[model samples]
Target: MNKLNHDQLLSLEHPFVKIPVEKFRSSLRTSQKHIEKEIGNLTDKISEISKKSVQGSMEPSQVEAALEAIVNRLSTLKRKLKDIRADEVLYSQRTKVRLQHLQDFATIQTLDSDEYARWSRVRLNRIVIDYMLRDGFRGPAALLAKSEHIEDFVDIELFAQSAKVEEALERQSCAECLQWCKENNSNLKKIKSTLEFSLREQEFIELARERRSQEAIAYAKKHLTPWQETHMKEISHVMGLLAFPPETKCHPYKRLYDKSRWNDLIAQFRSNNFALQFFTPEPLLNVTLQAGLSSLKTPMCYQPEHRNANCPVCDPETLGALAMDLPLSHHFNSSIVCRISGQIMNEDNLPMALPNGYVYSYNALTEMASLNDGKVTCPRTGAVFNLTDVKKVFIS
Candidate 1:
């Protein structure tokens, strides 16, 4: 496999840059279903009335009543169609604005100085806001976004919607979550998601744990019964919990009543919702940082003695710690820089190896020699060497 750096991978496959066609399609599908159902009902009613007329059983009064009803249905259908058209136009305008912002990211380098500054400010704010939102620091995120006036670029509302469901899940209430599941029931079923079933299971467990035997049983019969075909084994396992008391020493049943299950449901809901909306599971800040750090990481960065004070990858406080798990950049050829001159040792400025195994560019050694009576000192070790003794090294 060809190893691509984070920048390349993100440029090619970042979820943020991708158009949310699935989300749009999902909304359109709901509207299409409603419109089709209405048309179907209207046609069926018309067909029935026509059959009555053909049978010669329709009175004049019935004719007038049928005509009024048909006109009313037609009017309602027209209104619905008009509303859908308005919604479509509104959605298109919003999508175009968002697309314009996304395009700016790609063409930012081509912008003028003032434009670049404004874009950079918005981009930085967006990254910070994204990180804050993901970490549940919505108060701070909202403040920062409002102050910066970048709310339109950030996904504040999207995160808030999912956060509400998550908060309900945390409170041990599956109501909002279940409603969300119902709204996206078709998509969930298509993906064979276990989220809804899991939520129902948690509900049953909660009732059983509270010793509400009758209520638990009724809940299982109504909510859990539908999951039998796909989750029969799981259903059997959970139903067995009722036989054992909530305080029973049985490990399996005890685990079912664990409070951590709510956290699990919250996580599942976030993951499923993010997937549905085509949002990345991780914060964009973390993703961008990882990519940047990985591109700068090297084997020497881990060694304390070889560390550079100005190097981010060598600073243990922040970036270094973050880049610990990242792979080093792939380099087919080695690069050496002069310690004294801060210049690369290439064909023109050849590297000179000292007796102490330290390397410096020939130009740096020459400059040091000119000042130190033809004696060069190694920056790291502080060892002195005659310029004549420093052998020129050639890198293959």
Candidate 2:
């Protein structure tokens, strides 16, 4: 036999490959339903015969003949069902064989002993277990950890807490999340996060909207007042909400009563929590797969003969470079890049943080300052600042 290449060996449309397992399974289910209908008919006939016998409406000879006919029909249905099951088994075996062939063809048989040793040194399985736990698949993570004897490596309790916090957020109640944030407050503050205050503000808004003005005032005094210097305007706006009847349609105040704040707070809490735990807000695996899909969506990648050939998207030399070029964040478009030049900050074009904390490229800020004759207004927040107020940030 001629040695076949990977594409020919693993081709889904190969003549020897059986129909898809799902199609076979579906056919079996249809045959089973037919058999069930026949069984139901037999059961109904038996019930009718019993009723007739009880009422003395049918002779024993006639009943015996009816039962025999039903039994024969039932036997035939059973035989058909058995044949369908056999076909299912045969197809399942064929599928297994096809999968085995594909797996064998796809295996990296070219690796030498040194390369194999290097590959074995990398604990990818543990990384997968960690990924599963981090992504909230606790059951699978626990099972894998235990089976692999890596229970000491995984923090099952932290995973559980994360899951619980997520559930609470989904229900629009941030009480549990607030407690978690309190425990991680120091770390969150290091990141200059507004998460804790944001949660309190959301809660305060809820109190005012529910017509508990006194409680809302008390809440603000205890919580919102401490952050007043940093969030003074926001604190004042939230406090102004108490003056309006909850149903008032006042322009800016109307936004205070928007119910979406609850959802916004929940999302903010999750992002903060992830950051505190040293995890990216987005799952690494999901981001990688999305980037891969985006890069490989060109028509040439899906052609039949190209399956055995090197994929342009997967070329070793260009793969890392392409990934590096992908936007740092999925929400890159909405990120605080230079709105004027539409370019991200780089080492050469370091960002300057304005008074409002929005960063712009140093060059862009310079141009804006020159245009305004000394002071520049923030394109994002619309806050005005003197040229001297712009502080260059060294982003590592």
Q: Rate the local accuracy (lDDT) of all candidates.
A: 0.80, 0.69
lDDT (Cα, tens digit) per residue for candidate 1, span 266-341: 8888888877777787777777788888978889899998898767899988999888889999888767878889
Number of colliding residue pairs in each model: 0, 0
Clashing pairs in 2: none
- What digit string (tens of lDDT, one per residue) describes model 2 on residues 239-291? 99889877889967788788777778767766776665545555544454445
What's the CA error at residue 137 for candidate 1, in Å?
4.2
Residue 371 CA error for candidate 1 (Å)? 9.0
TM-score per candidate, in order?
0.73, 0.43
Top TM-score hit: 1
